[model samples]
Target: MARKPKLAVWKFSSCDGCQLSLLDCEDELLALAGNIEIANFLEASREVIKGPYDLSLVEGSITTPHDLKRIQEVRKISKFLVTIGACATAGGIQALRNFQSVSDFISIVYATPEYISTLEQSTAISSHVKVDFELHGCPINKEQLVEVISAFLFHRKPNIPAHSVCMECKLAGNVCILVSNGVACLGPVTHAGCGALCPSYNRGCFGCYGAKENTNTSSLSNKLYQLGVKNQDIQKLFRSYNAYTPAFLKESKAHD
Candidate 1:
């Protein structure tokens, strides 16, 4: 029998939601386990197999000096490295600190600020290493996560969409919340995922999936301004889960 392809999952500074998304794939995970050797997933199993892993799924942002060094080693050992979720791809909600003073925040939050050792800014994995692929989302869509892993296993491109949430809203036959309700939605510029869940229920999109490819965030922000959305509110919307992503970060700064 052929040796099973080794798989490893790593975490840095995150809520561990993305790792849980894999475990949530209860049935598909069982089938996947049959084909791959889950070499090092601390959340799933404490029994760690040694690396030079065939594929590695990395979660979270690089927020510390230790994380910066460790990710370089992870890249050296993994043949293919895929970053998952907003944290891995765009630095996540923690990236909000990038706009402010880290030292001031640390002094306020920590009992002993001197004891905490961290980078001034939270940054994505790709900012530090060569990422083979990026799966974007706050927690990620499980179906998409499975497709990404399977694509690497089969040596093919993952079939994830690059469209905005507006496409999903149209496909689902939901009314345009921005147009009809005069709501401030990030759907026009945000990536497609979460099945347009918020808009389906008459709520505006929160942009948890990050900015879509070739997003026109300025156009969308202008539309929000036209709809009577306050400038500060517009800035806050763009500075959410995927705040540190280039397109969203730039747009948020425009509002500032």
Candidate 2:
């Protein structure tokens, strides 16, 4: 009998929401296990086997020197590496510290700054090592996760889109919250994945998934200002889960 392909999951610095999304795929989990050997997923099982793994799904950002070194080792041992969620793809909410002094942050939270050992900035997995694919979102959409894994298993391209969230809203038949009510929305430039969630809830987009391909962030920012969104709020909007994403970061700096 042939051995099943080994699958591993790795973590760095994140809220673990993306990892939870895998578990949330309760019905699919058993089906996936039958197709691949589950190995080295600390979040799901205590049983860790030695690698080189067939595939690796990585969650979170690199915030410490140790994590930087560790991810390199993970990359060497994994045949295919996929980054999942905002932290792994765009440096997450913790990346807000990228704009502030790490020393000041540690001093404010810790009794002794000397006791802490951390990198100056939080950064995405791709900043440290090569990534085969990236799934964008704060928590991530579970169905998309399944699609990515299945596509890799079948040797096909994942159907994830690089289009704007506005396209998703249009497909869902959602009213244009921005045009209709003057809401400040990132839907014009945010990547499609979250299914236009905020607009459905009567709130503006927050860009939890980073910028879309060729995003016109400056144009969107100007429009947002015209919609009466305060400069500070606009900065805050870009400073959410994906603040360090180059497009969002550059636009936020332009506003400031």
Candidate 3:
């Protein structure tokens, strides 16, 4: 009999929403457990197994000196590492501080700034390690998470789309909020995973999944400006959830 592949999940500077997406899998996760060795997931179980692990799913960004060292060790132990959610793929909302002075931020957030030890910038897991694949979202869609894990178990590449959320909105039969009401939306540039959630409710996309492959944020920015979005607000929009992503970061810096 063949042994089940070992799986581990790790977290860093994040809200733990992405890890919860896994547990939220419920029955689907139970089905997955039948084929994989549930090795080291502290969120799901206290029992930990020794590595080198077959696959590791890393959540959150590297935001401290300790994070840098820990991720290196995780990289050394895992055969294949996948970064999940905005933090793991693009540094997350916390990356908002990458625009300002860390010292200033510490002084403002903590009474004793000297006691807090942290790096100046928050960054994605891929920035520090060779990532096999990235799953994007603030809190990732559970169906996509299952698909990624299933692909690994079966020895194949996951078929997650590289399309934009606009397509999803169209498919879901939601009236185009941008077209109908001149709303400022990141759907044209954001990666598709959330099923155009906000647009469904007449709200604009927040780019929770980060920039899509080959996105034209410049065009989107120009469009926003035409729709009467203020320049500073446009910059803020780009620098939201997946701000530290290269395309969005570069685009936002252009506004700055």
lDDT of 2 by residue, 139-248 (tens): 89999999999988888999999899999999999999999999889998899999999998879899988999999988888888888889988888888999999999
- Candidate 1 lDDT by residue in tens digits, 56-123: 99999999999999999999999999999999999999999999999999999999889999999999
Candidate 2 has a TM-score of 0.98
What's model 3's lDDT at 18? Answer: 92
- The lDDT values for all models are 0.93, 0.92, 0.93
The collision pairs in model 2 are none
Candidate 2 — which residues are off by over 4 angstroms? none
- Where's the lowest-lDDT run of ten residues in candidate 3? 29-38
TM-score of each: 0.98, 0.98, 0.97
Model 2 residue 91 lDDT? 90
Candidate 1 lDDT score relative to the true structure: 0.93
Candidate 3 on 11-35: residue-level lDDT in tens? 9999999999999999898788998
For model 3, the stretches where C-alpha displacement exceeds 4 angstroms are none
